[model samples]
Target: MNSEHTKTALVLGALSGLRTLSATAVLSHYLRYNSNLKIKNRRLKFLNSAGFALLSKLLATGEIAIDKSPNIPDRVRPGGLSGRTLSGALVGAAIYSINKRRIWKGALIGATSALAATFLSFYTRKQITRNTRIPDQVIGTVEDVIAVGGSVAVLEGDR
Candidate 1:
């Protein structure tokens, strides 16, 4: 097993757990850009040809805007958390596959990271905003920046 690849895959997967929707957009972009879905990666050819990267990124950006709204529900909600975990796993697999590593193991790492990050981010955000003078909107904005920046960094690491 290549530990370096494993680590990278885990980190990328965790990004998904943190912001699954946005992470999906990033990962999809990386996959689509890295591979033309020609001879090497026939399996994911549809992702590139169908413009999944473009569409997903747009949706993810929209969600980032919606996330700051007070009307947004907790990320730990059943549907939200489940989606994050699943997205993490899928992203992990995709990343590891690119590196020619153990795909399932990477997926597990991603899922675990997502579950952990969900709790950590949710509770920490709650406490920080509650105890500090910073407005929730500001904190949320910071988080959005982190999510998008981190996602881009993780995906670029593969290249």
Candidate 2:
């Protein structure tokens, strides 16, 4: 718990798992400040290089829009879950890549947290929609707001 690597991994990983967009939000801060973190993935590096933080914001906006569409599948579904996990890990790694620490710690925690959150959030949504008679779309919109707030909160913690 005292380890910065573990602390960052658990906190960022869980938040990212809960909402993949949180990754983009947190990383955007790093990019803006020209932080010491280094992104190893080619695609991620390119995205970061190409748009600074705009790419992440665009992707996050798209995700929020898609979340309300019925045509979109559950995030817990195989493909969706995989995407969440990958994004979570990458962003987690990016968050901890500074100081030349063990980056894999962040990756593992992010992926694991994403997997767990995928199931938990999915089930919670279903239950809420079923029991409360609130439409999933409405609930999803609320979730979008939560994601944004949570992402900001996580990044604020770094200060």
Candidate 3:
């Protein structure tokens, strides 16, 4: 890819991940605290899983069209998985606020996660690159782990 395109991709990918992370963080927090939450734990877990699957697919599309020689087919850039973590957190927070009938708290939860996601994105990049595994495999497996683990963890919370 051309330098300009590469730069654009890097910026866009990072931003996408940051957005996703923040969203996930809010979701995770909301679910954890929401007393009036009606969604069954299994259903909530499924929703989280669906989000990851969609995110992965989105990344794969980006890789095919823009990444060209992606190190991993589903690896959505470097910080993407961490971003997913942020998203889970956001989900939790949102639920907390909704249950309490305090909408603003949910917004704050989302904002905080967005800010944190940037740091997480950098840390994730470091970890993925530092591992001696082949770039493609590492990226691919990391993506799968994040996508699967993020959702599964909520379901396993009782354990």
Give TM-scores for every candidate, taking all chains together and pairing residue i with residue i: 0.87, 0.82, 0.40
lDDT of 2: 0.69
Query: Considering TM-score, where higher is better, how would the candidates rank from best to worst?
Result: 1, 2, 3
Q: Cα deviation in Å at residue 97, candidate 1?
A: 1.2
Candidate 2 TM-score, C-alpha based: 0.82
RMSD of each: 2.4, 2.8, 12.4
Tell me model 3's lDDT, rounded to 2 decimals: 0.41
Give the better candidate number (2 or 3) by TM-score: 2
Task: Report, for every candidate in turn, its global Cα lDDT versus the true structure.
Answer: 0.73, 0.69, 0.41
Candidate 2: 10-residue stretch with minimal lDDT: 41-50
Best by TM-score: 1
TM-score winner between candidates 1 and 3 = 1
Ranking by lDDT: 1, 2, 3
Better of 1 and 3 by lDDT: 1
Clashes of each: 0, 0, 32
